[model samples]
Target: MFNQLISFLDKGKIRKIARSHRAERYVKKFSTYNHVVVMLFTVFEGYHSIREIVLGLLANAHKLQHLGINYVVKRSTLSEANERRISTVFEEIYQDVYNRHQRAFSGQPFKQ
Candidate 1:
């Protein structure tokens, strides 16, 4: 189920955007994919703060690989990425994913 959810994302496109933004400039350990997965996981789980995100990820660290996440991210790293990376990168990914999948929904179409 987790893999299926992530499968919707075009990783190549995401990576291209990340490169264009130079989002990995100061980061050494975590990749852009890691950051996106962490953020998406937090949103899907309704985490309210970074502390909760860290704790939740730590608790599930063992199972993250199943979701294509191999590293246990540090709070500082996640915080830094969140602060430094242009948010438009993720927003673009979201828009791209939504545009690609919107036709599957039966309700009123989403427009962004």
Candidate 2:
């Protein structure tokens, strides 16, 4: 179910935007995909801190690959990425996803 939900994300589009933004220049292991997944996972699980997210992800590290997150993230790595990476890539992805999915929720409870 979770995998199917995440499958809706256009990874090609997200990666192209991330490349344009140079979001993965320094990190070899942590790609934009991993970063976004960790963030979305944090939001979905309601993790309040990077430490909590990292710990939770680590505990479920083996399952990350199934969700298309190829690597286990470290707290320091997530912190560095958050501090240095431009947010526009994710913003663009978010807009794209919302635009694509908005129609599916037409009768659902949402402003749009």
TM-score of 1: 0.88
Write one digit per residue (lDDT tens) for candidate 1, span 1-112: 6667788877788888889888879888787878888888998889999899999998998989877788788788888889998888888888888888988657998765
Q: Candidate 2 residues 1-112, lDDT tens each?
A: 6576687788898888788888878987888877887888898889999899988998888998788877677788889999888878888778778777887655764443
Query: TM-score, each model?
Result: 0.88, 0.85
Query: Candidate 2 regions off by >4 Å?
Result: 107-112
- Per-residue error (Å), model 1, residue 86: 1.2
What are the RMSDs of all candidates, in order?
Answer: 1.5, 2.4
Winner by lDDT: 1
lDDT of 1 at 101: 91
